[model samples]
Target: MTRGWPARLSSGEVTLRPLARSDRAAWREVRRRNADWLRPWDATVPPGSDARPSSFGGLVRRLHRLARQGTTFPFAIEVSGQFVGQLTVNNIVRGSAQFASMGYWIDQQHAGRGVVPRAVAMAIDHCFFTAGLHRVEICIRPENTNSLRVVEKLGLHEVGLAPRFLHIDGAWRDHRIYAVTVEECPGGMLARVAAPPETG
Candidate 1:
């Protein structure tokens, strides 16, 4: 494990920082308000699987422990010091396969103002330059147009589809895999995000 994580990253008003015990109120408030908006994309436990942490503290503790083990980076997404969402870099693998997958959600009120793309770029930059990982992938459900727009904005390559890849909203859902390697973003992904759009 490295010393700096769970790290704090920022670009303008968007920031990614470690989740903490004190974030219970703000986190719960945002999630509660956005439940209906987020339900379609949320992951659920299968019938036979063990129950996950019920309390906010337990969830934060578990993620912190995993961060110590070097397998995950759970972050609370904040815009100008106001908590708005979450972005997690999970399932990190080292050795021959230095890659990980990311998942995120944003408040409905802040959905399309470019907050997510900036956070994603920052996280990917950290994965490549700071964390020493080779590749980062984001798997999105086909119907998730907001998420699809994010990958499109960043120009990530769509590798393939994974049928029934993950259990989401209580059923097995297929996902489209989008990935970017360190080699592909040699100048860092944030730069791409900050660049002015190309006009046709």
Candidate 2:
């Protein structure tokens, strides 16, 4: 298992650190403000499912448990010292298949400006180098142009499409799978995203 967990990763002004109970108010404010903006892309509990809704405290506790088990790494995305969003690496697999899936959301006010992309690059770098993970995957709804753009900017390859991949926005939705292996970004994801574009 990875020794250090609940780690802090940063790239420029964007930082990814463990979400804490103390962040309750700030996290709630961002979620409330972006509720409408995020509705279409947010994951929802399927109707009639046995899963109970989780309160903020419950959610944080669960994330902490997962982190201790080395199965998940949850992060609060902060920009220049302000909480603005979340990035979670979930469903980690070890042994011969060292892989994980990543999911994220940002406050509408912080959308674009390369915040999410920078945060993602930092997280993936940590997963590969620090966590001893191989590949990382991000599944995005086709209609979510904003999320699709992040993977595009980072040059993550589109692996395929998954039908009814997840229950999101009140229904099972298809998602386009985007992934990057450590081999794909040998120098590190942060460096790749930070490098200036080449001109012919």
Candidate 3:
């Protein structure tokens, strides 16, 4: 029922597109393969949690509904045209506070190639330049060096730490909040990554 939302965004070597029901198989395979690798960071319900495990069909439905409400952009990250992982722009806020939170996971195979950073840069750029949003933020567990590097490369300013910020893999986790505003990136986020590393 949601009409005219273009499902694709591409830049450099990565592309981000809306996650669909048709991606179930690809999603499952990647998730299964990365289960052990990603379990520690997986978002899961807390102890004695009554939350039901999400179903693929139900997830797609919810994502579509959220998209219709303009509060989330659930996407699949692809590189060289192969589905690799997921990056979601969630907790979108409008009105006086135009901001959203980002969360992502990439296949272990793709972890070190700058795939996540490229995809993240594209998502934040779209949120600011095209979607008319004012701010974007990414929260990472302090021990998550990989996730930390993504924001570090993008130069997202670390705002502060939130104690017990999000439940992950069955327990509450602390998070380092990193954020950027439209006032900071007048040109674009992707443009910054694409810029040559300054040499002294």
Candidate 4:
């Protein structure tokens, strides 16, 4: 069985903590403000959907259950004293395969500010080093250029395409798969963060 891992992680300007009920107001505002920007790329929800409401309580319960089952880890992303987004490593498998799928979203206002990458790097380090996962995969809609750039910036390699991979905004959307194994992480994402920025 996968042992319990801590629910908090911090790196540079970001901190990832377990999602809490108190976060609802801030989270709701973030979602409300980013609604249009996020809609096309978001998972399908019913008409008149209120994700923050429908999913809030259920999310807490689900995270607790998944933590006990050793199959998922979810966190709220906080940067510079404000809740900005979420990051999750789901569908964890142990035994012969130590792997999980990565997913994340940032408030529209925080885009292009390096927050997601920092949070992602922290999460990747936790998964590979602390959680002992061998592989992590990120599936992104092919049209999400910004998200594609994130995975690429992290140095994950494109593995293949997943047809009808996910139901997004009411339809099954094609996604490009990218992966990075623990073995390939070398000095790890934390080290990569510390290294000098790549220059042209």
Candidate 5:
């Protein structure tokens, strides 16, 4: 069954919605402005030969195709009506291995402001509750302390490391894998946020 795209989710400070064609300009601007900061962490794509359409259009087309294939779900992170970043749950697998890998990036200006964690919590909730997935995995480069913190804050445990797990920024990079099962997250992410903190 084709799971319709999720409605916009909000956590008071950040909101997420399905990316639209109208967002191309703003998204491209955010990307260009954060190019240096994002390049080190983004997936590398081959250079295009023809210039008929801009790279942003090509990217939108690619995402639309993936959406139709049910292998990917992508969202634009918006803060106060501006596109600030992107989030994705890709490589969705069903049957015995009902899971997907999650990834995200934020505009440098929005970093360290709890934007990612809120957006991630929203995404994980959708994956487990709305999408009916058994588990979600987040793989991060060991050097990405910020990403590690985001997962840790969400209560996902480190499963293991995969050598040369992904081709990022042109080369194969090792990644530390972390995951949380639906059974382990019965109450969903919102529950974690509402639960009382533990005292030592």
Candidate 6:
């Protein structure tokens, strides 16, 4: 169906678009430099499983195919037109569920500045509205305070702790699940994040 095609999703300074084969050079540069910064939080190959794919193009093609199958939206995040990271909306389940999960990473240089929250807001809005999803969730490791803040800023409710939920950094890591349903953000996810806090 290729419903969304991972189009250019923009919110203030952050922009996200489908990753391309041409992004190799720049993406690799940022990824390599941030290798130390991101490694501890990265997913690792499960023990005894077959070797994972080693090619970036192969990963891109798989994501593109998932988009066509109407199961995922994989995007490369950009700050002011410069590539900085990737945000992928995966594990899409339709039918009565209509749910999806998100995973993202940004260049360490762009750590703060509200980039991740806004980008997440934009993506959630698209999933709930344009893509007809009913729920979206983000799972983060306990020691990942920065990622923890991202979900907090967007006011996603804490679902619970998941023990040994994912394999990360070469070992099984527990995760804290945070989620928001369409009913929780009646004004829309993007608009909710843009709203000012109420004053007494």
Name the best candidate (by lDDT).
1
Worst 10 residues of 4 by lDDT: 45-54
Clashing pairs in 5: none
True-vs-predicted CA distance for residue 18, candidate 5, Å: 0.8
- What is the C-alpha lDDT profile of model 2 across 17-117, one tens digit per residue? 99999999999999998889999998888988877438888889998888889899989999999999999999999999999999999988989899999
lDDT of 3 by residue, 91-180 (tens): 898889989999999999999998998899999988987788899999999999999999999989999999999998878999999999
**Candidate number with greatest TM-score:** 1
Query: Which rank order by TM-score, best down to worst?
Result: 1, 2, 6, 3, 4, 5
* Candidate 5 lDDT over residue span 1-200, tens digit each: 35735456888768989887889889889988999998878876435534333467677778778877888888899998889999988898878887999999999899988788889888888888887888899999998898998887788899999998877887888999999888998878866755677889
Sorting all predicted structures by lDDT, with the top scorer first, yields 1, 2, 6, 3, 4, 5
Residues 20-101, model 6: lDDT tens digits: 9889898899999999999999998997987665888887888888888988898899999999999999999989999999
Clashes (candidate 3): 0
Q: Which stretches of candidate 6 lie over 4 Å from their true place?
A: none
For model 5 the TM-score comes to: 0.90
Off by over 4 Å in 5: 4-6, 46-54, 194-197
Predictions: Cα RMSD each: 0.9, 1.2, 1.8, 3.0, 2.8, 1.2
Which segments of model 1 are wrong by more than 4 Å?
1-4
Clashing pairs in 2: none
TM per prediction: 0.98, 0.96, 0.94, 0.91, 0.90, 0.96
Clashing pairs in 3: none
lDDT of each: 0.95, 0.92, 0.89, 0.85, 0.84, 0.90
Q: Clash number for model 5?
A: 0
Better-scoring candidate (TM-score), 1 or 5: 1
Per-residue CA lDDT of candidate 4, range 19-121, in tens?
A: 7778879988998999999999888755565654266777777776787789988789998779999888889999999999989999988899888888888
